[model samples]
Target: MTILQPQVGHETLELLTNVLIGNGFSIGISSQFNYSSLVELCDLNIIDKKLFEELETSNFEFVMKTLVNADKLDKIYNRTDSTFLHAYGRIKRSLIEAIGKIHPEKYEIDLSDNYVLNKTMVRHSKRIFSTNYDMLLYWMILEDKKHVDFFGRSHNKDGTLRFTPNRESEKQVFHLHGALHLYLNDGYIEKLNTSDHLANHSSIVELIKEMIELGRMPLFISEGNGEEKKKSILNNEYLNFCYKSLEDLEGSITVFGHSLDNEVDSHIIHALNNAKKLSRVNYCIYTEGKSEPVIQLEMSRITYLFSGKEVVFYDSESIRNNMRVIEFYV
Candidate 1:
């Protein structure tokens, strides 16, 4: 397979960051007054009048410090509850948009059929995993008639199967986190399956408003240790499919767009580390600035467990163009 490296541009990166933050807000992971939400809530006065200046200023600072730490965020909130709600809301919104809007049209990549074809070949890769909640990759695979198994929650609930029907044997895309469009209410994870609603919900504004008014709540996951452990792949079929796929695949694994942020997901990385068929794995992160804490942790985990394997980082921009000419040798 020929190697292709696509470079990500500053504008493209900015758009991606904006999209992630925006989606995070809509999901209540960040404060309802975060940047993108502010654009929506500000005009509607969902933000309190007296706190308008404070909210707006805090939003600006949130963008400035990158919200990478707690002390920086503590500047705005006096309590941990406020900090959690605000930051979580923003993160949720940012992730939603990142998965939704990342594409050539938004990033100036030539995502024509040819480019898409090239990218699809790369993704036809063995044992792929994503922590994202969006269905963009699934949609792309469907469009291409390529088969990739998803090992994530079919719905974010217990005792429910998360299976992708008609998946072929050669390729896989596993989702570690529960998908946003999929909801779990009564031991069932229901798909809000709609072409238009997935991308543009006409009532999203109202829905977000309602969720914001509801106050700090964990809509993403049910509380308690028992419920938390149930969500793990060790018990979930969809996620275990990914684990087995990683064990069976005969080449190196590559990752993109994931931040290595959660400990539960560290299981996947460790599994890949222990895989017999895999010798060395590569990581293609979105930015070089994240080299110290985020990327370093990924490496530390892998090296500590599998010293023989290698972890390499690539700038997203440099590899963005490789899609245009990818001839998958792997």
Candidate 2:
């Protein structure tokens, strides 16, 4: 049985899915969801276009870091400037809106071939772990109509589905990096679900937009390195649980969509290294062809990371089929 752990690589969104545009990747996205689109948002939202341009990249994580540093620099210099803070708020709002608009409505996707996706991506997996913060995978669960099996039933008192693992539930999904519907409240992670959409919103995307506008930014961890990501994960119980789950597997695991680079994802590598019983890994890789040398270098890194373990490389096509979460329908 394969425990499918899907994550984005440090760059270019190589994990077969590019819900959010990755820097330096040849991701196919509509004009509405590209970097220029984000710049348009910055202008349309009345955010300082100069400030946005200064960031020099479309990656939200990098932008957040620069804003954070700007805020810190203000304090260090004993200067009182609300400029970055205001821009920061506007950017966060824009970021959430960007995702809301980019996230496809269910009807936009052709769910006709869900069976092929289920047979290949879900049926054989013991557990499914995803690192994407978008709602694509969640939509896939909605398509399957077995969210009860996919999402655990443990609810906290606030009606949010708590990540409480139970013995009877063999099938489970963990949003390891948190999603737009998840937010931190009173030290606990609360997941907004279908009911939230029905009661107060037109769609999940709108619900997410409303939540972020109301200052409930979902727990998105876009920190650069594993240590930074780990620190962010440690702050929330649900996220920590997801990260730690990596070390508990005892059989073969199929790592899809994630490169697990030691520098950016060392925490994950550390966890995998701890899974002593994990005998085999069915790792996915992009077909080299023209990029053979680069792919080989990556394989060497992967090999070095999983030393002494049986790591088998497979073509990216397997997981690429499941990446149908987005563009395939179009």
Candidate 3:
């Protein structure tokens, strides 16, 4: 493991930041703060206690995989029962509710700095990809309402909402992992409109609850293993498109807030490895009290994943001054 620290006042830091500002880059956001928010939601009784206990006993990803597998194998008279399926459904709804409750809708004003940072990134970047199920990025894009395009449903001249296909935009946001605002309606993934009725976090929770009551489950890939996630992605049209978009990405990409865990994040590794046009990969390491060896190990792991690519490790705080908004809910 090799440690390379670029100081705040160093020329290298300034050059890297300027490069990021000028060149086209892709961003990969993961479950760093969102996971903690979910845990907190559980503590606050927003998520059911039994389901929370199951999540604590076994990881949330594991529980999701188990439920999905059981549902698939239910007809074979496996150990899965109706009660288990019902419980799983309840857990799914609870997870969405929890995400909505802790989502960054109301905090957009508080996170104005983060919004600016992301907006600037979006202005320069081609795509922004996130593995979190929360709607933080979606809320940010809606708040900014500038160059970023969601590519969602559009209204025709007839005043009816209709699905538009093959609409291309330079500044796009992809939810690599399905988000709380996307729902499965008649075999198509559609974005839920948050601007309607001044919907806040709690209203979004209620909307999801209503969807659950109407027999619609949120489209989210919460499988524990990378292969399972890949399978789920392939099975879903929207997720498959997101995965393909990742594979087709060209140029530099910056990864932030993701741990790059091999087990659960193999898809990301595979995408980054397959991106032949990727010139440089910048990894933002949040080194608060972490030792040199720990940071080195993380950088080496990412370097190993990206083999021949130029990998740069920089302090996350230096790259973006509003680290608090990115690391925690405001």
- Which parts of model 3 have CA positions greater than 4 angstroms off? 1-93, 100-124, 147-150, 154-165, 197-202, 322-330
Q: Candidate 3 on 1-330: residue-level lDDT in tens? A: 443444433333232321222101112222223343353454323344565465543234446556666677786776546755675677666665665555434443334555455544443444677776655566666755643334444643433222344767655767777766676666556666766523554656567657655656666765456776787778777788777877776766767656677888897778777877777777767778888787777777878887888887766656565332433432
Q: If the candidates were sorted by their lDDT against the true structure, best first, what order would they fall in? A: 2, 3, 1
Query: Where in model 1 is the C-alpha error above 4 Å?
Result: 1-127, 150-167, 183-231, 261-264, 285-305, 312-315, 327-330
Pairs with steric clashes in candidate 3:
none
Give the lDDT of residue 72 in candidate 1: 50
Ranking by TM-score: 3, 2, 1
RMSD (Å) of each candidate, 1 decimal = 12.9, 8.5, 7.5
Give stretches of model 2 more than 4 Å off. 1-88, 112-120, 145-158, 318-330
Per-residue CA lDDT of model 2 for 170-288, tens digit only, reads: 55566766777777666566667786455866778878778767656677665456776777777777777776666676666667657676787787777777888877766766563
In candidate 1, what are the lDDT values of residues 106-192, reduced to their tens digit? 122234443354244335444445444433444455465544443234444553333554446555555544344344334333333
Local lDDT at 254 for model 1: 54
User: In candidate 3, where is summed lDDT lowest over 10 consecutive residues?
Assistant: 18-27
Q: Higher-TM-score candidate among 2 and 3?
A: 3
Candidate 1: TM-score?
A: 0.46
